[model samples]
Target: MIDEHATPDLLELAARYGVSREFVDWRGRLTTVSASTLIAVLRALDVDASTPDAIRSALGDTELAPWRRPLPASIVQRAGDTPWIFVHLPHGAQFRAWAVLEDGSTRDIPQIDNWIDPREVDGVLTGRATIVVPADMPRGWHELFVAITDDGATERIARCPLITVPERLNTAAANDETKRFGIMAQSYQLRSNTSWGIGDTRDLGALASWGARQGASFVLVNPLHAPAPVEPIEPSPYLPTSRRFRDPLVLHLDVIPAVQLLEGPDAERFATLSRRATALNATPTIDRDVVWRAKREGLELLFDYDLKDPVRKRAFGMFCEREGQELVDFATYCALAEEFGADWRAWPQALHDVSGQAVSEFRDTRADRVEFWRWVQWLTEEQLLEVQRSACEAGMSLGIMHDLAVGVHPYGADSWAMPEALARGVSVGAPPDMFNQLGQNWSQPPWRPDRLAELGYKPYRDMLRAALRCGGALRIDHILGLFRLWWIPEGQTPDAGCYVRYDVEAMLGILALEAERAGALVVGEDMGVVPPETRDTLAHFNIDGTSVLWFERGMSDEPLAPEHYRAHALASVTTHDLPPTAGYLKLDHVRLRHELGLLEVALEDEIQRERATIEEVLDTLRARGALASAASSVEEHTLALHRYLASSSARLMGVSLADLAGDTRSVNQPGTHREYPNWCVPLGNGSGERVTLEQVIASEWAVTLLEASRR
Candidate 1:
């Protein structure tokens, strides 16, 4: 319940900033946000809403904000829609508006009627002038220039960035009606004999090739976003250090040209590291720290050799030039992390800001280390592109569909470099949901909605561009965040959070623009706590949704029929958050949650509920002729589940490699960090024995299940 003492002024201020005062909870109960929580969230957005006077002042600011500026921060619109742009100026001042196109051409914007008078702002009389943009304007990045004339004298000109995007993104293939199947794998868990303890681009390429051979059209992998450059790296890809860059750790060293030039001693040293790292494949859990230590030594050797080659140096320079300052800041952060520590907050205050002189000097002084990180990124880009090329050549229609994590680590490169781009005292999270009643705090900073519009969404656009660079498709994890994010105030429980809304029109417009430019398909992980109209909006943008078989229920809470499934979605039997199909059938997730103390109810009660759910799904499959009434084996059930997915009208089907190998371990367990080894489970068999990539691909069980998916 909200604080009884909260005044209407405070509630109005919160509403003005797009904050939700009350929301329906997972239990269908209306929950009002506490006044304190609202104040804290407002403060995080740089609004001083602690007192009545403060609330009044903030409310005034929000209304006068647009009038104070001559032109808006940015204008984003769909290609065919012609929108009116308001130009603010001193009363009686004349202004002319035009657009500087992306190709250096210009278009005149006509003035329109504006009867509403602007109020006095800061004691200066201001008036709004309406400008009608041409409907035939090209779809690209352009600049809107507004020049104001006062008393027949030319005043200063204001410029605003403008973008026109396609009306909706389309399916990756020309034929949108056709259904396609793909294989989903945790990238690092798919180790091979040639891997250096973790799966690399080589392994991913191999998987893509194998999937193509199985009549698959794509391979979906975990987010390959960069982690901490030094040791003690974060294991979960969902909590990446930077979303704007690729993780160099996933690069295949054998593909680097510099590796071929190693001398006798250098070769032996690299071989020793490779041999030691490859031996890690026999281990049950992935040790990223151990893998990094060995791989780093070899990477340094390659970096040194590449520096000496003129052609390689030129290629690196071109890459740097193309990446610009964002790449430099990431490399500088990595170098600084290696010198001091991964946490930038603990460093000296002068070194905290990437733009500060102290950090610039550190980059100049530790030039070699900074260059090494840049070189690593270049190698990563090369290998990822090569893998995509290989996948396409091997007959995969969509090739690799890359996963994009929702946000960056709170103390990672993005936060350290561009602190203003994200909120300071809030974390992105979910309100209490059915799975975890305590809710989930991802510990990642949410982008400041106000700042995103002010900056013309450059940070968001840059990160999306990077994720879509080398993949045929990109999956936006927690895509609902683009419209509204649950903002949990610092030092408070996740349930104390309120929803903060974003400009969905602008966000989706930019997304459509980027995806169209990349010629990639977009899939939104719209699974949990989604707003009622979110799917409709996503579908309008032609962005696909996610559908996990177990969660798709009908009005009676029974399994949804295959024909009832969404046609514009990526359907799968299970996701990384849940156990494999075999493990799910055996109630492994319920048992694991009970063991981790994450279950709200008794273990037996939870187990009984889970069993009922599985039985209901089996009944649906049996009715559809995809399963036998007497079938009891895990393999049989897994195939039946695949058959159920195949019978659906979903445009894309994803089969997890874990299910193919009969791996029982959950890739991740929500709400448990150290208690359960999240994101560390290697691909293995039912007996808990480690299975190599080749073995998983060649397994008869894998072939049989894949054949079922193609039905």
Candidate 2:
């Protein structure tokens, strides 16, 4: 419950900042937040609401904040819609507002409202006024300028960032609202003849080509976001060091032009490293650290090569210019991570801030190391671009739908470089729910809602811009975070946390703007417990939702009929978190969770519940004629599952690569990390023997299974 002793001033202040006093829990019961947690969250947002005097001061500050500013940090609206802009000035001051077009032209804006009641605070007289914007503004970012004068003798200027979005998000494709099937794969686990210990962009291209041959229109892969630049590289792609850059570890060295320069001694070293790394391909699990060590040595040698291609040099320079300080700061953090440690929090105080003098000096002194990291990013971009090109050339219409991770690693590059962009004490997580009764703290910081507004959402916008550059489609993991995130206060249980709100209109508008510019389709992973109207809201913005076949069943425990599925969604039979259908039909996930001690009930009791669920699925499949007979094998059930998906009206039907390749291991088991080889599991057979990409592309079962997905 909220603090019984809280002053009205504090309560009001919290409300104005979008702090909720009570919420309905997963059980659909009303729940109130504790006082300490609210105070901690408020403090994280830089509000001092600890005492009665502090509450009074905060209330006054909130009232005067908008009054002091001539304009808000930014204003967003739909194209052809006019919204009133507010301006504050000295009492009785007169002001005229105009829109400054991006091309340096100006248009007059008329005043809309009468004088806001005058007020005297701290012996200073202040007043507010409103400007009426024209309804025919263009669909881009422009500037709002207000010129003010107390007595027409002195002049003052105020400017704010203004944006107008499309009335609705344009569909990802022109005439593809109907069903289209694609393959979903964990890229790193894609075993192939040419894999260099780990999967590379080349393997992704090959997979797309194979999928296209099988009559697929798109291929969605896991997040390829970069991990730590140095050794001890993070394994999971979802927790990346930087969302704004690609991981070089996934690069195919054979495609780099610089590899041709290794003709003498460099060639020998490269071959040795290549041989050592490729040896691991025969193994069942991927060791990212070993792979990085070998790949880094090769990249180091390539970085020293003198490139004489002026055109390529110019392109690299343009990339640097476009990325600007963000790229530099990431590279600098990578360099310093080697010097002090990967965690910037424990680093010397002078080096904590990326903008500080110490970091500048370090970059100047360690220029070679910095450039080496930057060079890696350039190479990564080239290869990713090539991957998209290869996929399109192979006839995949919506080729390479890249996944965008929801958060960054807590102690990684983004956290180190831009601390102000994220909150410090609170972590983004979920409350205790039916899916996870213990609750889940992702261990990544949430973006401070106040800070994001103050910075005009540049950081969020920049990340989207980078992620959309090389892919034909972009997938946002956990898209609900754009509207509201569950912020767990430091050292507290997840249930003690509260929701922190964001400007959904602004976030979705910027996302739509960027996706449109990239000519890419947007897909939101709108699975699990989300806010009411989440699907409708995503649909309003033309963002496709995610639908899993297993969870689409009705209250009667029967799979939904084809007509019951969503029309604007990417429907799949299984996701990375669950096992392939073959494995699921055998109760593999239930067994694994039980073994991991993650089950809330007794193993036998849970098994009974799952068995009932499985029986229902089988009955549903039988009724739809998807299953051939009552004695169908596991592989047959897998096909039946996808056969059901193919009949759905969903826009994009997705078939897992694991099912196609006959791999049984889950790519990720959400409850446990080290207990299972989460992201390291290779695509293999039932015997746990690794299956090469060559085998998969030519597998008869794969060919047979794909037919079930073709409508």
Clashes of each: 0, 0
For model 1, the superposed segments whose C-alpha errors exceed 4 Å read: 1-4, 171-175
Q: lDDT tens digits, residues 1-711, model 1?
A: 234466898888989888989887877788898899899999999999877778888988988999999988889968888899889999988888889999999998899887777679899999888997788888888899988999898677999888887789854552266899999989998899999889999999999999899999999999999998888989999999999998878977777788888999999998898889989988879999999998888999888887789988998899999999999999999999998889999888999978889999999999988889988898888889988999999999889999999899999899998898999899998997878878999999999988888887899999999999998998999999999999999999888899999999989889988898888899999988886799999989999999999999888878898888889899999999999988899998988888888878999998888898898889888887889999999888888889888989898999999988889999899988899999999999998899999998889889888999993
lDDT of 1: 0.89
Question: Scored by CA lDDT, what does every candidate get?
Answer: 0.89, 0.83
| Candidate 1 lDDT for residue 659 | 88
> lDDT, candidate 2, residue 598?
74
TM-score of 1: 0.98
lDDT string, candidate 2, 44-115, tens digits = 888888877787788888887887777888888777888887787888888888888767788898987575
List candidate 2 stretches off by more than 4 Å.
1-11, 152-154, 171-175, 555-558
